[model samples]
Target: MCAKKMTYRDALKEAISEAMRNDSRVFLMGEDVARYGGTYAVTKGLAKEFGEDRIRDTPLSESAFTGAGIGAALGGMRPIVEIMTVNFSLLALDQIINNAATIRHMSGGQFRIPLVIRMATGSGKQLAAQHSHSLEVMYAHVPGLKVICPATVEDARGMLQAALDDPNPVIMFEHVSLYNMSDEIEDNTKVDLKSAKIRRSGEDITLITFGGSLHKTLQAAEELAAQNIDCEVLDLRSLRPLDHDAILASIRKTHRAVVIEEGWRSFGVAAEIMALVMEKAFYELDAPIARACGVEVPIPYAKHLEDASVPQVPDIVAKVQEVLNSDV
Candidate 1:
């Protein structure tokens, strides 16, 4: 097998670099992404190689820069706009929801948004409420945009290329907690952005998750394995265009499901999965689906509270058992 010694960060960087090299229309813009190398440093050294013309940096005005990216994209340039965090992306709500999202359909297919927005999301570093959010539900709720949250080393490296290649606008969420988690990465060969992958196989239950919560779901699966409960783990790599086939197939096998989302408990992506499960696999389900999600309260500044605000392994474990025991 072809392989390389790389972290998820390197994988993500290589993906962006390859896209930049292959497409003249593809360029990056955001606050500190050019010289300072991005808030998460994933775009470091890119500005030096591509120069400021392509790897352009902008002021801290999230709404203005986001709108600029939209304009540039509509004008035939593919712009990868980076927001430091999803919390700040809220500041660009009008530009994203009203403009970038609806431009294609609203224009009767005369216009298309070939734009990509990259932003860091979720809580783990005690950054508190202002800096943390799992906004995939918010973005996915929009009809005109595609949302992707890559939780693996290969995806972190490959999804950028796939997102940039797509004809429509896409929003990618890179969870802050996943930046440093090292897994031996195999470069570029096995990556695909259009489908979900079953990370671990089992028949007792299916644990569905994405983004930072994926790690916790896997941990919970491992813990369940010790009890002779085989839990399958399904990574919903692409959120908006969810791999419904993969989800339903896993549900068909397990007949029990638990969806773990790092976002709030109310009206989150987990709720979407529950709806889909009922619609697609209702007859196959042996029990009601369960969701393990973050509390509805704002993320707290304390380290312990911040950790508790989001779903944890124990939360996943309990939810899985609840589904296994409950009858729909």
Candidate 2:
């Protein structure tokens, strides 16, 4: 397949456009998503292409629009609800958890909420506490919701279609920092939102991460490679139905592991991955599993403090080295 270079933002827009064109049932509703061209400009020309009816614009009521999306899905329409950012998604938590996520189970499998919710998550752009957050862990904690984070351009372009095809509610988290990042993507590329993908294969240590932290982990792996330490980079594309086999396989081969997450260390995604490793791959380890996570602090507006709060390339590199040097 021929590959073309594109930004993550463009990839996402292409996915939504393709889905909307192929499926008449799929429609988008959110604040500034239509005439305003979206808060992040991902839906810039969508309104014109799909028309205002399909690319609808809603008021600043997250709870209302999100709830409407659930109702629409129940009415046999596939609605793509954009919540602007993860911080604003808190307003629609009730609609998401109580209704969209629980409908299938509560209705005895009769009613399935085939809804897809897209939101920008994580911190890096100095958006402060209100606009920036890595709250996918909270969504992942929900039983009925399937949470996915597309860290690369290819995944960003392909995951939305898979989410739309799902019978259950799927939440797609796009890292705020990766929208402008560009990469080569095949013209006919499609990705499954299921298993963990090994971004880089290696033997010495494993660097596990997803979403915004994937790039940082890859960079750290490159640095470790220069130091004669081969590091495998694992991208957990699907967070909820985590690929346990893929994670375990990586740990079994590498022996040393470092889990990285943009969310806070305590009770975050990184912690969950570490626990999984300890539970299933305990005997296959050479050293204790380490984690590089965001400091337990509200992301600051200042660049320096915000940078200090989240996991970075240096942090991943340091954690990998620490795990490698530790006694088994």
Candidate 3:
């Protein structure tokens, strides 16, 4: 069982390349995906390898290209649409929500969109409010879309293939900060599009998070470990169709839980997870479930202000401690 060391960006590129090589039906279309080799350079050398037809580039219009992707998918092609960022995805909300997400149901199963939309999400690198956003929750709220946030190199390398195999549309959120994260992935890695993974196991408080917040939560767990406070870190890999059984299993063991997310506090993914714990695992709790989330404001352009707006290691550690110290 040899492991290959690579950055998260490289892992993603491998996934796309493998899919295109294996399936003639699979192709990628988006702004600068081919010529510019992706905004983050995840698709750097793909165009040269796969050629322009398979790695086609589109105009700057998110709605137009996204709709074109939907049309291609409907025509029995597996189209991978790469939006520049989550903030820009708002322009394609109509095509995503109204069309791609509802075609199967609206047509009574006559049409299925085997479309995969990838977008960079989260606030980092001083991108400001317009370019930085944690909008996965918006797509997860829809019924027909499968939303996934892969927080590890393994998941990043494997989830794209799973998404392409599905009969419905899938949206992948690649955190803007994770592109350069380097780690070893198992040589024979297999990733599912569903299921939450417990990155670290502990009997004390459970730390639940996904996407960019995952490393911060795991780091918080490590810091808490040194202070004699054990923390279980749960990565909610699949946002839609959340693995409730896995979540409740961890909650049952840990008793106290703290959900974390980079999205705003109000009606965010953390809120949904906390509410689920209350509903299904209420009697298993030793204290009230808590959450740490982003401040409800447009992300700032300044470095310090931007960092303060999102959850960090210290923020997660404090939240875990607060939940652990509860007298309830």
TM-score of each: 0.96, 0.98, 0.98
Against the reference, the lDDT scores of all candidates come to 0.89, 0.92, 0.92
Q: How many clashes show up in model 1? A: 0
Candidate 2 lowest-lDDT run of ten: 186-195
RMSD, one per candidate, in order: 1.4, 0.9, 0.9
Please write out the lDDT profile of model 3 over residues 1-328, one tens digit for every residue. 8888999999999888888888899999888989899999998989999899999999889999999999999999999999999999999999999999999999999999999999999998899999997988899999999999999999998887788789899999999999999999886588898899999999988899999999989999999999999889999999998999999999999899999999999999988998898899999999999999999999999999999999999998888888777848
Question: lDDT score of model 2?
Answer: 0.92
What C-alpha lDDT, on a 0 to 100 scale, does residue 12 get in candidate 2?
90
lDDT digits (tens) for residues 124-160 of candidate 1: 9888889997888999999899999999887887787
Error of 1 at 114 (Å): 1.2
Better of 1 and 2 by lDDT: 2
lDDT digits (tens) for residues 247-299 of candidate 2: 99999998889999989889998889889988998999999999999999899
List residue ranges in candidate 3 displaced over 4 A. Answer: none
TM-score-wise, the better of 1 and 2 is: 2
Better of 1 and 3 by TM-score: 3
